[model samples]
Target: MKYLAVLILLVTACKSPTNKKMEPKTYLDIHNEAIVIDTHNDILMKTEDQGVIFDQDLTGQTHSDLERWKTGGLDVQIFSVYCDGNTKNSYAIANRQMDSLDAVVARNPDKIVKVANSKALLKAVEAHKIAAMFGVEGGHMIEGDLNKLEALYNRGARYLSLTHNAAPDWATSAADETTNPDLEEKGLTDFGIQVIKKMNALGMMIDVSHSGEQTFWDVIKLTNKPIIASHSSVYNLASSQRNLKDDQIKAIAKNGGVIMVNFHPNFIDNSFKAKAQAFFERHATEGDSLVKSGMDTWYMQDYLYKKYADEANQIRPPLATLINHIDYIVKLVGIDYVGLGSDFDGINITPQQLDDVTDYPLITKALVERGYSEADIIKILGTNFLRVLDANEIK
Candidate 1:
């Protein structure tokens, strides 16, 4: 009887809750342990416009900072090298944006490193440093010169978005495709074909985020390597021209590329547009005053949006809506071709519960709740982008 009691006590102690050594990892653990990457962020453009330092504490004024990026568990980031078409020296201004990022890397050498290839990217991730690279958001910054494109690539730009809101001489943009009536052409020009070939030769991933439908098809017909729609969502879900149609999504998968979905509310939720439009109309006088005071247009909008965040929050889509975009792509193609490209600091608004860089874990948690397997969650988080990056590498 005494030996039986001793054996029972030992068994109970061994089965205690605190004694569980092989317990399953939670969503937070999975998120923190994965190699999370954000393929597009326009914080550099904001920093340049506002004359603010990226490594400094910019809690309220900006959506990203070095420390906040770390807190967000971002293993890699592709900073956007951007300028509007109005700039006379677009190439020089783009270089200045690259210089801004370079300065940030110099200031936070221990926290981040500028990586150009897959090996360096892996090394940065292994060392727990954010791997930084550039996705030149507008091809106009190349100023119709292949030499300038090569120079941007040499400066750590791994991808070149063929257009922004406006088309360059080489390619048409979504804005022109759906809105412009006087447009002479709607696809890539002869030089644009050359640009695609040059990017293929240089091993830079061709990004078609802001490209018009015709431009997208033109590149798809011409490119030798896989491409990336670096920051776009599904048009079926939200009717924005910036969003990809079902045919485009299918084609991207067929061409072996990934679509890193954007988190902007306007792109994720169709209804948010009318609500946002109303909000803008309600604050039109204040917006006019800010612009009249010589503030930048984007800055004035950002100011109004943040100042009236309560009104803004009422219209913001739930985080699940963004996930639904991911889910749609996953179901349309497969898990191998979808990932996150949260357009941080570039858009005026994000989905609810995703306020800034640190809110990334919420996405992981939501994925888990959505019944995605851990393997698929990891792929969606970063591995899919890595696969596309590797596929685009020069062999």
Candidate 2:
């Protein structure tokens, strides 16, 4: 009888806290265990702007800092090497961007390390260093030189976004397509085909983020290895020219590529773009004065937006809106084809909750709430990108 009673007690004690709900996995636990990779971040450009080094704390002023990246559990970050089309010396500017990143890695060897390939990337992550890499934001930076492309790859530029908002002589941009619909070449030029082959041969990932639809398809048809939309969102959700259409998203998946959703509220919500447009019209005179004053139009507008932070916040979508883009890509293609490319520092108005680089854990928590398994979240967080990276690595 005593044995029976003890057995009953043991069974009851071990009876699986079924009545008590299993506590959800802490976000920190998930974020810490996962190898988090942000494919696109533009804080490097900000460093160049203010002559401020990333090794120091750049809180409030920028979305990312060295310590903040570490605190955010950023295993790998591909710093964007970008200069708009106006710079006469585009190639020189690109080299200078690379130089800045080199200097940062030189200064903080323990905190971050520049990675040239998947092998080195994994090694840096294993050693608890943020694996730093370069992603040239515009093909114009190469100045139509295959040699320049080769040089960039050698310089640890793992990806080359075919275009920024402005298409070069060799490619067309989404912005150009939308604003002026009568361009001669909507995609890559013949020489541009040569560039694609060169990138493929060098094993550099091709980014179709800011490319026109024709440009996207042309590259999609040519690239041998898997490609990526490094920092684009879904057009269906936001109705922005910058975001990909359903067919494009499927094409990326069919080509074994991944789409790292951008966090721009304008790209995530159409209503936000409308609100932004209205705000811009309201401040048109101030914007022109700021431009005339040699203040960067972006900074002036940012200042105005912050001055109206409450109104701006009202228009800004919630964190769930950003996740919805992720969900759209995951649902349309598959979990293997979607990831996060926050476009932090590059964007002015971020989703409400994602204030800075430190807010990445919220994404994991949101995913858990959305019923994604840990494995699925891992794939979305970084593994999918790593797979694409490994595939594109030079043998």
Candidate 3:
């Protein structure tokens, strides 16, 4: 048996994969060669808040930073320009977030390139630079003006999600449906349809991640190009409003859109929200006191998680759970319609082993161990998003 093991090792010789050799490739080789893309990240929002400088090391502070993106083998990133529903002057906040990204790129021009379309994105990849693009996370940022949408496109935004957790007047959100079930005209309005058409014309992908069922169906019915659930998970596993239902996943596959699985534990694990809810309840008095003192709820949650890191880690799903969501999507659809969209800095809790942006290659290693061929791994990592981007970029 020992001689057989020696013979096996001697036969393979640890060579890289090739046509003639048919030798197994290392996970690092596959990951480095692949055009790794993450379609949803919130580091720009963190930068906007002056929470961390992206060009510097953000270890133990934020999930992403420029140097670490390279360390992580990230080739492309769609920086989400986001604002909550209650934000006053939402458009300005979105623009400010964009400005912060602009500043980061300006300071680190050699490392990152802000790309507007698929062509430019590929060019950046060819130049060995991280392609930075924009994704407006909420429709409310446009302020019901198609011109603002156009402005966002001109500023390098590649997608416009119809809603966030808080739906605007023109469109409903999943949270809206959950809270106001009896409301009439809950779907996309006439103006919302116009916005969709305008996005199509501008070559911006219609993102369905945060939308309600009506809005999702509306985009499927109206958009001329492929849609993207830029960052979401499977509802069957997690049952969160942020996760997609099976029918929605099927609809996206049928429409040739991609469902980029989100890595947020609340959206990835079925028991996460409940356990987290109870944990927060135990600290409700402190949380309420913090909130009353003007601390953001999200910030308070992060603080609590850090304070209870061990318990938090116990509740977080294993890294395999993230892969399981990807596997589920692949089983339901084909390999072409699923991708990675780790919410990273945007997420409160990531599954164990996915500590920061630097952990992306672990996904490649996991996929390889699961028997996904290199070509399939490449498409899942980034080409799926590129296919949709190219399909939308046909202007």
Quote the lDDT for 268 in model 2: 93
lDDT of 2 by residue, 90-120 (tens): 8888888889888889998998998877667
Estimate the overall C-alpha local distance difference test score of candidate 1.
0.89
Clashing pairs in 1: none
Please report, in order, the local distance difference test score of every candidate based on alpha carbons.
0.89, 0.85, 0.86
Residue 247 CA displacement from its true place in model 1, Å: 0.5
Q: Which candidate order results from sorting by lDDT in descending order?
A: 1, 3, 2
Q: Could you tell me the TM-score of candidate 2?
A: 0.92
Which parts of model 2 have CA positions greater than 4 angstroms off?
1-24, 281-285
Backbone clash total for model 1 is 0
Candidate 3 lDDT, tens digit per residue, 1-395? 24323432332233223447656668988887778899999987787665577888889899988999999999899999987877889889888889888888999889898987766776777677899999999999999899999999999999998999987889999988777868877779999989988988888999999898888888889988889999999999889976899999999999989999999988888888888998899889988998899888998898788888988888888899899999999998889999998988888788999989999999999999898998889889988888888788745
What's the alpha carbon RMSD for model 1?
Answer: 8.7
Q: How many residue pairs clash (N, CA or C atoms closer than 3 angstroms) in each of the candidate models, in the order given?
A: 0, 0, 0
Greater-TM-score candidate between 1 and 2: 1
